[model samples]
Target: MDRDMSVEEHLGELRRRIIWVLATFVIMLALGLWLAKGAFDYLQSIPPAADLPLHAFSPWSGVRVYMQFGFILAAAGTMPVVLYQVWAFFKEGLLEREREATIRYIPLSILLFLVGLAFAYFVVFKMALYFTTTVNRKMMLEETYGITEYFSFMLNILLPVSLLFELPVVIMFLTRLRIVTPRRLQRMRKYAYFALVFIGTVITPPDLISDLIVAIPLIVLYEISVFLSGAVDRKIRASEARGSLAR
Candidate 1:
């Protein structure tokens, strides 16, 4: 009966957190729509895109792109709030020291996400776009890009890179929770590299330069994750040693 009651309480808490995240997302969506026009214009002013002319293939294309931009922006804005809620929901089950350490991850995760987004937008995305456009120009093809297609490509590259940037933090968290260890990560390094390389190939343009540009960062992120996991393991071992000495 007690276990059943605890499960019910956890479910209820989860439902509440979901509701809060949804509400926040909805509110931000409205604000995002209002601001999306300026944001779109600013993005267009950037290189690669700046030289190209974007078109609306259909009457609804503009509206659809606006909504897409709004959705992405709103989701990005609400991510921190949602992450915090998720952390809080599971926090009570953690030890005092663990709770203190893990709580700091909320902000770190958000920062890493933003860094990824920026890197994708400023570097990988730009290079890919430029490469494609240059090829088209060289082939004597007129470049008429649809707004919808343009944004779709951007999101495809941006979202994955941003999420991939969280690898270190996620690995560290799992290490802290004893779900994964540095040794395990080290053992899996070659497989992880293959997976990351595959992901980079999928996300970037089909060219060696683009693939290498994207894959290198992902590989670096994985290495960083391993290093962070090692740090967490050392800390855990030190804590255990202290506790044993005290006893």
Candidate 2:
């Protein structure tokens, strides 16, 4: 039997979900600490450089590493729980049919986010590092760095790419909701190109090559979004037309 949930009940459930999510994050944090070195090494593999002496400001550096590893792992490990909670909350606000339609999309969105982060870590981030390091190689009198700074840079690149990679999911959902049409998105193609180029320039270092590298993938993602949007638009429109006919 279906029963309506009260506001108090919903809040209580949310609190419980938050606790579960936090517990998941803590467990993931411990696991991350155990694998911190491996994670660091994986990130290091991308830069393709000789052993450069890296320092940590003692206790603070140690803390930074622990926190950084925890953040990355927590984001990765708790993503499903996080997405579920988000869906749960938003689903309450949506029509029953819409909620049911959206249930399966969350996991796919999470996968896309991970793919984006991995691409950033392995491809875009590495390329950016290579380009930047080579360009400023002449300025590095000391050939040494801080571990905290290194991790900070890693996070900076990883976070944005992961977020940006959600474009396809966003397009799909907007299409599903009939909020945007493929024709409209297509019409804005020139604007999207400029917007992506501007964003890439802002994120990447001040170099033509770096900006182009970042912008190129973004443009491709936009084009893919356009395709997905068209498909979703057709599906939603067909569903709507069927409903209208039935009425």
TM-score of 2: 0.81
lDDT of each: 0.88, 0.79
Q: Per-residue alpha-carbon lDDT of model 2 for 3-76, expressed as tens digits?
A: 37877887888888889889988988788778877777765554443345568866789678877886788668
Model 1: worst 10 consecutive residues (lDDT sum): 1-10
Residues 112-195, candidate 1, lDDT per residue (tens digit)? 998999999998888778878889999999888998899888888888889989998899888987999999999999999999
Best by TM-score: 1
Candidate 1: misplaced stretches above 4 Å?
1-5
Assess every candidate by TM-score.
Answer: 0.93, 0.81
Candidate with top lDDT is 1
In model 2, which regions exceed 4 Å deviation?
1-20, 44-51, 92-101
Residue pairs clashing in model 1 are none
What is the C-alpha local distance difference test score of candidate 1? 0.88
Q: Give candidate 2's whole-model lDDT.
A: 0.79
